[model samples]
Target: MKFNWEGVMPAVTTKFTKDDKLDLKMFQTNIKAQVDAGVHGIVLGGTLGEASTLLESEKRQLTKSTLEVVEGKIPVLMNIAEQSTKGAIYAAQQAQQDGASGLMILPPMRYKSGDRETVTYFKEVAKNTDLPIMIYNNPVDYKIEVTLDMFDEMLECKNIQAVKESTRDTTNITRIINKFGTRLKIMTGVDTIALESLLMGADGWVAGLVCAFPAETVAIYELQKAGRIKEAIEIYRWFLPLLELDINPKLVQNIKLAEVYTNIGTENVRAPRLPLFGDERKNVIQIIESSLKTRPTLPAYKNL
Candidate 1:
């Protein structure tokens, strides 16, 4: 099925219990809240969801719970990234069966490899399912960059459709738009450059901060879509500092804490990934609190 993918697809956080178990109830509540707030889609199992730390079972459960909450109201894109091609394909097929609208596949991690290896990896995974696939290009995390040429090659797969452009370079965004705008649906994965990406002809944004502030994120996109540039910039300036905080190494910790402070989701995160503590923790708290205090009044939630 060809789905029209667009707008503020949050790389949602997976809510965990205090002991770091997957908190399914909290996860459902969070997804329900985003759907109610009118986001275009929910992107579970992505970087912000802490997908790397989740087990295969947990990934399946998250997709199941998300399907229940969203109730077919909006599209769901599951991020299936693993060190092994087989694992990624397994996860993608499971998510597709569980009613996910599409799969966002990341390059295999843990081994430093060349472009041919990376292309082979994605091709293997793509062959496994008929679900629409979005190539997630985040070079910083995966240590592999899928260039424009590689993207063109992948487009021949037909089911390999959209792209989540996470690189912070607008030039690359322009290059992709210039080359493949007609063939692919490009979405900005970087929160800071989301507006610029949209202005440069990207179809939508896959934002991380939308987990904390969905209304504001949606407003920015809607305003831009309506050609209300001045108004969108005004909201963007107010929210940019909070978006900046998301680019830190301690992002998951900060985002979870912000969710807790906003009474949206739990502050719990799994280990190997720990909560922010001491001065580092304090600095994130201070920034979020300050943002909340200075946070511009979004139009009535009804107006949104």
Candidate 2:
């Protein structure tokens, strides 16, 4: 599968059974729903996917399972959040060997690296893999900004093709475009501002909330692309509250709860991250339930 580096690619959650095992069956079901809803691609093992908690073997298993489900219709990308250049390179190579279409590689985790070190890390990983890479430029949470100047350094690596623009500034989208032109595909990484980012000329969205509401997420992107701004805005306004859930520290729990309500997934997350309980659970459920009640009928977007 060729990586297009565009459109709504869900930073999907890794599903688990009560026993904390990989629930590949439920994973497949949710992925099938994403496919049925016409998503552009599937990204596995990211922040939402609990990449930190997953063992190397588990990540490989998730990648292989995802490839099986998506088949060849859409690309399945693995997220590389390793802390070392060697580990990142190994993870990149493993993803390639396991049949990942591309990679969403973060800068060195745990220990924050400065501009020079960060650029070197990304360049090193790109050198090791033939797969196209999306640099996760999430300075707010990750504490390392992959600046335009850094991108200048990375230009020689042809495989470093995209940026997951999670900087939370919509203007950064335009800045990226102005600086690089089509050299780097800019996919907006924040959920709450996704439509805003798309409207601002972002090439696509690396969405989080799409794990539960795939169709609505895809519809927002398609409608915006189709020039149906009025319709897209209406749906986006409805989706705003739910979209806010993706930014919280407890996002995995929040989104898995949304999935539970949507009947697409369970709330069984990995350990050290338990399912939401008490008022936290209730509050999240309130948002999910409220949104579900007035869930807008998606207009025909396929022909758009």
Candidate 3:
């Protein structure tokens, strides 16, 4: 279960029952779909996974349960979005103990640290855990940019291996590669621009919409890796509208609704986040349904 930090790794949604309990059965079902579709890895408790709402025990349960379903077929990486350095370090240690293959960690949540502080927070967490880490450099949403200079400092930590590049600027992929070379791997965290990122030499995609469209998502990555550019674009163009859902504010709810239509998951979310409603719900459904009407038949490609 060594994490290569490459390929389509879903920022999978957390399934919930009617009473807002962990619906592990449904969670496993989605995991199986991802595995069967030939994904390279699985990322748990991410933004799309509703990481903010999950309890510590629930996160541990998710890691264990995802490992059970993947059965070591692919690496399962738990996300760490804690508000404190100590909390982040403890979460990282807990994930390793829970048998997670790796971790996708963010800079300190709820507090925007400077470049030096951000690097320190990540380095501290990296030192405390043996697990390989994919640093989530999502300044667009989180407001703390992990600049290339910060990364230069963080390279001291061997475990700080990969980056979940969500800056929305595709050129940053090339910038990271230029600055760090192979020392740090880059995975596209934004769904809409994933193919562009890959074409620019990103190692993998930490996807969100893949939770509902596993096969299509995997197809895009595999096709790209195989140098089937035309084929990959055909699928990506069809997938663009659906993939845009991941960038919205209610991404969790947006993706969950897509899951409901796709029959892979339910629309149940925790309190403070409800299912999509009114015109918003109608518009999203229109997009999902429209895409489903003409979903493309994927061309055969080797599962890399």
lDDT per residue as tens, model 3, 109-160: 8988888888899999999999999999998999998989999999899989
Ranking according to lDDT, highest score first: 2, 3, 1
Candidate 2 has a TM-score of 0.98
TM-score of 1: 0.96
How displaced is residue 109 in candidate 2, in Å? 0.6
| Backbone collisions counted per model | 0, 0, 0
lDDT by residue for model 1 (186-298), tens: 88888888898898888899987888888888888888887888888999998988898788887888888888877788888888888888998888888889989988776
Candidate 3 regions with alpha-carbon error over 4 angstroms: none
Off by over 4 Å in 2: none
Q: Rate the local accuracy (lDDT) of all candidates.
A: 0.84, 0.92, 0.92
Off by over 4 Å in 1: 300-304
